[model samples]
Target chain A: MTDTAIEAADLTLAYGRRREPALRGCSFRLATGRVCALVGPNGAGKSTLLALAAGLLRPTSGRLAVLGTTPAAARPRVAYVAQDKPLHPGLSVAETLRLGAELNAGSWDAALAAQVAADGELDPGARVRSLSGGQRTRLALALALGKRAELLLLDEPMADLDPLARNRLMGTLMAEAAEHGTTVVMSSHIIGELADACDHLLLVSGGRVRLGGGIDDLVHAHALVTGTGRVADLARHTVVESRATGRGLTALIRTDGPVDPAWDVEEPSLEELLLAHLRAPDAPALITPGTTPTRAVAA
Target chain B: MVEYRIDRRSGVATYLQIVQQTRQALRLGLLEPGDKLPTAREVVEATAVNPNTVLKAYRELEREGLVEARRGLGTFVRRSLGGAPADTPLHGELLEWATRARAAGLDREDTAALFAAVLEEKFPQPHAAPEQAVPQPQPPPERTLPQPQSVPHGTTTEGDPA
Candidate 1:
């Protein structure tokens, strides 16, 4: 069995006859049994990437795979929870979940769906239109979970949830992923929430993957160092993103080896790393952070 | 079938609460070797706590050899302590006090006296059962239960009465 749940190689996609591609040369492999967050600013092509993975939109160039099969061939193994709520407005929660089970053409566990609904605090008798935003999101999650797909794709799963609801939903997703070994690729704008839950992260910006790796390794490779001396002296070794405080300059430096004790070194958070990449021009083609880059394969 | 309770108003982090409850369950023989735990998802739903918190607790438990995770099968009670002495991590006692304080509506100061009284009444130190001995099987002490406090709007504790 292939260890990868989803793989994309040199993918370039555009909407209709649009002059510019929505996503260009995007490539990444989502390993099985890991939670990956696809993060980017608005119009950074997060949706396009998810769509290509889900087989909802065909890529104009390159290849995509879901569960070691071409996107089309792996449709049954992939479950896409679209950004637009896809529930039937007329259907009650139970009926909506039932319909999903019927439509997926994959293993569907009715009992699991009922359990997920109950766990998410959704009343099966409630109609879809009557549910609150958080409830609707939970219902979507339940529907996705019940499908028992090998790869689950979620687009902005926490978009409409309040802080508390978001926490609860994230928790549910994490638990489900850990317990079942489900390979999940979810997109989110909430960087902090994603940092806490996801083991691996993908930062997509300007139609390319600027940062990708395990969270710890990324943090270790990028040191937030502050010094009193002119930062240009440090520029050769580090990427200076900012200067700060009264007397010192704070720089985000990429180091190939252990950090020197002379400089106060702190790990850059996921958000800091993302912002740095999004700001730089002609950024490294792929910054694997503390590891060698893997070969990009077209599905 | 370990029974656990959590007060949403507690100052303690939820993961610490989970650790204490798991320890208590072990001491009480409520769970046996190989007993399945509610998946992290189930625990979060049951307690209304963060999933990461549940994971943190489970991870600690796994490290302590108190629980084991079976890939695709969920977490399970691995080895039973059987009333034997077990190491209570530093956070464990802090968590117990926090839980009691919330239940009784007491602040940090009030927790000490109540904790002392309970300790003296149950396992007096010395012949005192080991620090991690089974929670003395006594009826829950009769402390003045806190009157329900009006929770502030938008606070996470709003729905949960203290």
Candidate 2:
């Protein structure tokens, strides 16, 4: 098994000569056999990152590796599930799986493919256009899994899935990871769901990673403290988010080390932490250079 | 042979409900080592729940070593409560939480109180049965109390209404 499924160093990507870079100086490594969630707001270059990782688009600068080999060289071992469902409307579910198997230069076992389809709760005869959004997503995942790729790059795989479907897909993905040691890097907007399913999280904003680490580590590093006393007057060790609250100045603070005894502290949820990033003033300026401030990534 | 009872009315996520049910089944010996589990689709069909709920439960079970997935076969019960030992992910999560609480300067008493509150909120105690198996009537009201007026910050309330 490869030590690292994905590694990028000082990567910069752009669409056109004059177009601003979609991603700038982004660097991170996703270890093999781990589920890593890439989270950011709309147009934060998440799709571009996946494309570069999958070798669909080459980085303008820096380096990238997928499964111990450059993405372009490891095309057979790397599978890219694009943000949009890339299914052919005229093809049936089985046909689509067959196409994936053929493209990957792998054998397509009818019985095994049927079993996977049944497991995914997809009808073999159902046309791509007739399937619901969730079904389409499942079918896409099934196709990817059937290809037996070493590294799976899923772009917004759970965007259209319902809560239950999302859970099931996560289970399937986890099983795949454990059994085959497949490396999965999936992007998602649902921070809480990702927190529960993924072990590692990469928080991206303005085409760069603001934070990347194990989920437990991030939660332990930050806390939400509520108190009756003035938070600003206590000390400068804590980074106070806000001082005004209906219930006596509840503040979400990040402690430099151990929390002080004066304030009551509780661990903030992933959503709260993500919101803090979105609420920051530099969030808009972080993305594009000259354009007007667009939607904040954290919110 | 594991039996699961789901409370659809509860606000908890369905996957969490399934996880609790599976754990209870293992504790009760309803499921044993090497027992074959219903497929995700079958569970969804039988329970009339989403396939994802069953999948999520199975994923948690796999993480806990309570279940294993056989490629091209299906999920099966791996070990019983007394089988080979391994530190499940949930245990790690609990330990992480404890460390965080400790780092936050929370004492044993504070941690216990917080845990008790969480338990009460997540799994409330059942009310005792009445003689008629129905809710008891409330006692008659003794007197009406007026709502207290809001006081300004640092304002003296001694001279106000008693």
Candidate 3:
């Protein structure tokens, strides 16, 4: 098994002639056995990136790899749950499970799939058309877990579930990672939800990866400093965002070293760091040690 | 097995919360020596937290000599935090004292404030250095009313004019 779960180098993908590219020159590496959060604003190419990694969509330019091989070759070992969660509307819940079992045959885990379905109290006789949005999500997740794939790529997996179901499903996902060392990358708009369950993060914006690394490392790499000073005073650090508070200038800086003692420095929270980068698109990006690909990208 | 309730808004790191909860359970005699801690899988499955957070907490507990992990078996409590056990005479005495305080017309908040003040005076810094023992000075025999030191919100003596 490869140590790297997913690696992309200068990956670019375009839709049609009129619209901007979905992903443009995006690159990052996700290590195995990590629960990573893919977060970005609308049209930030998060879904496009996941699709590219899943072999469902091809990039217009640049390279992408899944499990140390081409995405197509890694399909059997990877599970991708699309945002729309397409399923046969006519098939009964039981029939859907049967179909999954048939498709994945030798590697399918029937008991695990059934347990996931049962956790949601999904009825076997119910048709897919009859299930609620949350129920369909539960069923989709059941198939994903049942496949016993090594890497799970989920796009906004918790968007429809109620709070209790969200918690329960998250717990199940965490347990799977704990036991089998599965690498999971799930995208979500809720920062608090992701903060609790994810140790690594990929912050994509404007078709580019703005931040990618271990959450703790990324948070520690920058400092939130507030002091009575001007922007010129912060010339030494890479300032992501800065605003003038009533008493002084408060800024988020990717620290070069120990910040000057004149400014009171504290670590920015994950949300604050993401928001700062998202607000200032031109800030120099910092891809910490592990998240960088072993092979350098061709400019 | 002890279940952890994670408060996302608590401002406490998730792993630290786990360690604090386990230590609290030990001090209260809820988790005695030889009791097995819930596996990381079980904890993450129930709490919806990342599995690493749970493992990190357990590793910290192991380093403190509060728990031991056997090769194949799960982690077990090695020793309990030293304090007055729940069913001991000290607890009974505290209960009686609480009853007297309530009868003396102190509201729950007032009593809590008073108790916390006394605890602060005695413990000084309960969490400063759990591993290192600090020599404590004995309290005087003649008890004087602990005029609850100026409370944070400055509402300690609000209702009573006396």
Candidate 4:
């Protein structure tokens, strides 16, 4: 089996000529067996990227690979849950699961699907049109998880669920990853919740990958230092964002080596790191060593 | 089996919480030698934490020689931490002292601070240097208290004494 789950080399996509491109020359890689949190602001092309990886949208330029092959070729092995969660309105919840089973006959995991559906207390006989948004999310996730796909591409999967449901479903997702080593890529706006459930992260903004790598590695790559000095004093390191505090200037820097002892340095929390980069999108993007694309793309 | 309670806002790392809870269980006799710790899948299924975090906690336990992982079975407790259980005379004395402290109008935070001060005096941090061991610089009373570890909030009545 291929170790790389998803790899993109300078991938770009646009809806029309008038509007700006949704994804602008994006490139990154995700290793297998990772539960990665794809986080960004609204209109940040998160959905577009997930669609491209799901084989629903073709990139306007550059290469996109899923599961060591073209997205289209890996469709059967990848599960994609759109934000809308389009399901047959007339079909009952049980019928929907049956359909999923038929579509993925050999790989279908009926017990797991049923259990997930049961955990949400979704009535099997209830029609899809009559289900609430959160219930619909539960059913969609049931189908996606039951498909036993090697890679799961989910867009805002927990948006509609209540707190209890979100926690239960997230637990189920983590269990699946533990048991089968599934590579899950889920996009969500809740950074706090994602921080617990994900070991890796992708922070996309302004149609580019601003931060991509293991959450710990990316967080450790930068330091939040507060000291009495001008911004120029940090010339040796790459400063992502800096602001003047009451006592001195506090800046987040991608450390090249040991920081000077005069400065009080501390590791930035995941939230701090992401916020600093998000506030300054022009900051030099950091893709940790293994998360960088394997193939060379022409600049 | 020990169920890990994760406090996302506690500022303590998630894995360390698991490790602390396991150690707590061992000291309380809730987990004994030859007992099986919950599998990583089981822990993640309940806590929703990253599976790797569970594995990392287990590896730390293994490294400390407190637990051992069998190939096909699961992680088993190698030995329980030797400590005075809840029913011990020392525990009773502490509980009585806490009750008296409560009766004496000592609020929970005040009681915790006083207890922590005594603990720090009796058992100084092993890594502290001679100069640093003289006495902590007192800025504010709150800053003098030991930094909270994985203490679950609202459970100060348990006489944990940690």
Best by lDDT: 4
User: What class would a CAPRI assessor give candidate 4's docking?
Assistant: acceptable
The residue ranges of model 2 lying beyond 4 angstroms of the native Cα positions read A107-112, A119-132, A229-240, A281-299, B1-162
Give the better candidate number (1 or 4) by TM-score.
4
lDDT of 1 by residue, B1-162 (tens): 553465544644456677778877766567767788887767754554445557877887777667789998989876655423244353576687589778878876687787788768764544344453332221212222232334332222212111
Model 2 root-mean-square deviation? 17.8
The sequence of per-residue lDDT tens digits that candidate 2 reaches over residues A204-246 is: 7778876566554555556777667676644654453655676
Deviating ranges (above 4 Å) for candidate 4: A296-299, B96-106, B117-162
lDDT of 3 by residue, A122-208 (tens): 999999999999999999999999999999999999999999999999999999999999999999877889898999999999999
List model 4 lDDT by residue over A1-299, tens digit each.
Answer: 68899999989999998889999989999999999999999999899999999999998898988988889999999999999999999999999999999999999999999999999899999999999999999999999999999999999999999999999999999999999999999998779889989999999987899899999888878888888998898899999999999979999999887777677777788899989988988899999999999864222
Rate residue A186 of model 4 by lDDT. 95
Clash statistics: count for each candidate: 0, 2, 0, 0
TM-score of each model, in listed order: 0.68, 0.63, 0.86, 0.89
The count of residue-pair clashes in candidate 2 stands at: 2
Q: lDDT, candidate 4, residue A179?
A: 97
RMSD of each: 12.7, 17.8, 9.4, 6.4
Q: Looking at model 4 chain B, which ten-residue stretch has the lowest summed lDDT?
A: B136-145
Predicted structure with the largest DockQ when compared to the true one: 4
Inter-residue clash pairs, candidate 4: none
Clashing pairs for model 1 are none
Q: What's the TM-score of candidate 3 when only chain A is evaluated? A: 0.97
> What lDDT does each candidate get?
0.70, 0.66, 0.86, 0.88
